[model samples]
Structures are given as structure tokens and as C-alpha cells.
Target: MKKLNVTEIQEKPEGFVASVKEELNVELARTLKAGNRMLVDSDGLAFIYIIEDELDYYYVSFGKGTWPSLKKLLANQGSLDLELGNSLNIELTAIADELAFLTENIEGNSNYGEEMEKAVSDIFL
Candidate 1:
């Protein structure tokens, strides 16, 4: 498949992100970083890229920011009653449901439009 030049992806990414992904999976799979840099994010979005290898590969990621609310709710579970706990539970379930969308590898690429849209929007902004 044809790939988007790194400069286009880095600079003028204004089209639908799925389209961009169709054109840039090879680039992203090779160029994106692999972990959260909470420390570096004050300066910008801490992009973490990871390239796939045999026996170890992944596509999408939900970093600390994505699950912190659920983590906090679970950590403070003792302080919540049924009503509050139900609400927190709902939020936690949602976070888990959202995270469950991540695939083990490129097997899920065709369905990554939602995530790609969010990531590309964040990066291009």
C-alpha cells in the first residue's frame, strides 16, 4: 500500500484520520513512541511509538490519562456507597470497555478509525 510521507503526517494532516492511517500505518508502526511521558507532555503530547516484532506486538494504547479516573475510583472504593459506587462503577466499566478496543497487532487496523481520528486530531492540533 502507498504510504504518506512523514512530513505530510507530521505537518498537514487535515483529511479523515482513517484515510491517513491507510496511508501511514507503516510509518506510524515504525515511528510512534511506546510509552507515556507525563513529564514531557507539559511541552506537548508525549507521542510514544512502538514497532512490532515476533512474539510481541500491539497497535493502539490507552495511557495513564485514559484510565486514571477509573484507577482513582477503584482505589477509593471503600469511601463510596452503592449509589456513588454504581456511578464510579459505570465509569470504570466504560474505561475498560474503551481500552478493550486495543488489538494485539495490526489485525485491528481496519477498525481503528475512532482512535486514529482522536490521535491524529491531537497530533495535528
Candidate 2:
């Protein structure tokens, strides 16, 4: 799947939402809720636990100070669904890129690792 530019995402909400649901095995309601949470907050750190939880199902390994790194990995993986490919009208690419960078460049204690792990487990339960 080709990586979408941010503009393509903003212009087509239905398509974007649909693709995310299909690829992530997430319902539209859940995706929308998560997306809204991401949008309302500028810091990706707030979403670390959520993202970590989601990734657990895929068996991806994440390390301390690796939240940003994981975002980059997801962005690189990109979307394979056709609906999302067509809905590329928003600035989501840049937003995604920024989030990836933030995640990759973050410097701090690794205490959040356990917290994120627990949060992921709880959410999945």
C-alpha cells in the first residue's frame, strides 16, 4: 500500500474511517473515538497506552522511549485498504509523520513501559 499524503486523509472521512476499521479490526465507533482522542490532544504520549494495547494483538515489540518509534513503524507500514487510498484529503500524513517523529525523538524515563503494558492488557480484557 502506498503511504497516503495528509491531504488525502482529511478530505474523505467515510473512506478513511472504513479503511481503518477493516485494517485494524476495529469498529468504526472505536476508530472514531480513538481518532477523536488523538485529535483533541496534541501530544502522542497520551495515546501511548492505547497504541501499545492495539499493537499487542500483533505481537509487536516496543521498548522504553519507543512510542514514537512505533508510530513511525506504523506509518511506514501504511494502509493497504482501497477506501483509505481514496480518502486522502486531510493533513493526516503530516500529523502522522509528526507523531512518528515525536514518538521517536522522545527522551524520558522508561517508567511508562509498565503503565502502558497494563493499560493495554486492561483494554484488551
The candidate that achieves the highest TM-score relative to the unseen native structure: 2
lDDT of 2 by residue, 49-93 (tens): 122223231111123233333343455544212232334311123
1-125: candidate 1 lDDT, tens digit per residue? 12211111111232111111123334334433322111111122222222233434333222324333323333343121111111221011222222223322213343445455354334322
Look at candidate 2 and tell me the lDDT of residue 49: 15
| Model 1 / residue 96 / CA error / Å | 2.4
Flag regions of model 2 displaced more than 4 Å: 1-18, 22-91, 105-107, 110-114, 117-125
What does candidate 2 score on TM? 0.24
Off by over 4 Å in 1: 1-91, 103-108, 114-125
Overall lDDT per candidate, in order of appearance: 0.26, 0.29
| Alpha-carbon lDDT of model 1 | 0.26
RMSD of each: 18.3, 13.0
lDDT of 2 at 77: 44
